[model samples]
Target: MSDLVYEILQLAGILAFAISGALVGVRRRLDLLGVVVVGAFTGVGGGIVRDMLLGVHPPVSFVHWPNLAVAIGGSLVVFFVHPGITRIRHFEVVFDAFGLGLFSANGAATALEAGQTPLTAILVGTITAIGGGVIRDVLVNTVPGVLTRELYAVSALFGAGIAVGIEGLGGDAWLASIVGGAAAIVLRLTSVARGWHLPKPRFTDERAATQE
Candidate 1:
């Protein structure tokens, strides 16, 4: 992919991730600084971890201040502007699904570009998709969605799988990323809209009482 295209994807993914982070903070009624912290952390935590695992010093976001600027700015925009941005009756899931698609695909591509194996790429993709949200949930005192939702990690895995397959077939990075992202978004949105959940373990009364 062209340097310009790579940079654009990275920025778009970061912006969307940070926006969701800020929204989470907003929902929790956090102060402005708290919002920024949560947003920045959620936006870049996975990428930073990925780079560290790859032995890249300073990581991409730290090396380039624009990444930090974009994330922080995005969060601040949400903090101050989202309130006045005209409330959509259904904005929550809409933005959440969009962010899911953007970040998960970018994460998978980044992992593959760093020369991770296919399985590792998929794992990284799942981490990148949920890492931020996990942090956000912990900070906000909620359960991480992926822990309870069947389709969350599944979507990321599916995207990463598609990305690896496409690249293995000699497809362009941009095209692969797009297809992967679109697939993730569609599947995730469908799961949410349909209220699809993973099966939970059932305990017998005797086992439950014994455990208790």
Candidate 2:
């Protein structure tokens, strides 16, 4: 994708995740400072991790003022306008889905640009999509959504795989990004609406009898 488009996607992802984190902070009854802190972490923590893993010194989120500005601005807006925002049903879920999609696509694309293999790019993209949420949930002492929620990381992986596949096939980067992101958003929303979940092993209720 073009640099401008990539930056725009990054900004959108940052704002979306920031709003979700700020909302969680408000729900947790954190003070304004705490809210902003949570918001900033949730917005940029994943990107920082991704950049660090890619060996990008200083990380883009730190050097780019607009990224931090957008994150803080999103939190400030949420702090001031939370009353109306909270009234919207599933507000957090919606924003989280958007952020997941955007981050997954952008992360995979960036990894490819950094010359990562497809599998590595997919893994990096999945991490980039969910790492911030994991941090946010840990800060609030809750289980991370990727561990318990419906297909969260799975959705990110799917999106990242699509992006990697498209790029491997010589498709346009921007088109790959859009398609990958849309795929993630659609899968995540559908899973949420339909209560789809990954299956876990269940132990048998009856125990074996002891030998005489």
Candidate 3:
């Protein structure tokens, strides 16, 4: 795809992700400032980290005013509008899944553009997809979705891996992103619909007592 389209996709994905993060802040009853902070963090935290690791000085967030603007703007809208765009019964979960898929694709692409190996690209992509949510959960005093749900990280990993695989196969970057995003979205949606979960380690009464 053209650079123009890629840039647009990147921005749109970031804005969508920011809105989801802001919703989380709203659900937690945070103030407007907190909403903006969480939204911006969620939108750009992973990309920033990935760029830093890849030695992309300043990262796109610093160089691109629109990226920051969209994030903050999305947060503002979410703060004042609440769930402005949806009346779905599971709007939060749906949007969170959308953001996860979007960011996973974007992150993986960014890693490859930075000349990272396929494995590293996928890892960076996974981090990019989940890092913001992790930070948001930490701020809100809850375990991240990935820590509690096996499917969350797995979904991201699948998407990132697909992106890396496609790029390695010499496919178009945009096409690769779509494939990766679809894989992530399908995995997450399926898991949610099916109530799939990773098992937690079992502890016997004796084991618990011994630990205590």
Can you give the TM-score per candidate against the true fold?
0.88, 0.93, 0.89
Give all candidates' CA lDDT scores.
Answer: 0.76, 0.90, 0.81
Worst 10 residues of 1 by lDDT: 85-94
**What does candidate 3's lDDT look like per residue over 33-83, in tens digits?**
998999888877766776787788988899988888888998898888775
**Rank by lDDT, descending?**
2, 3, 1
* Tens-digit lDDT string for candidate 1 (137-178): 777788987788658888877777787678778887777777
TM-score: the better of candidates 1 and 2? 2
Higher-lDDT candidate among 1 and 3?
Answer: 3
- The global Cα lDDT (0 to 1) of model 1 is 0.76
In model 2, the worst 10-residue window by lDDT is: 203-212
- Per-candidate Cα RMSD to the true structure, in Å, reads 2.7, 3.8, 2.5
Residues 1-212 of candidate 2: C-alpha lDDT, one tens digit per residue: 69888888899999999988988888898999999999889999889989998999999998999999999999999888988764433888888888899889889988987899999999999999998899889998999999999999999999999998999999877777788988999999999999999996565653433323
lDDT of 2: 0.90
Candidate 3, poorest ten consecutive residues by summed lDDT: 83-92
User: Between candidates 2 and 3, which one is better according to TM-score?
Assistant: 2
Among these predicted structures, which one has the highest lDDT?
A: 2
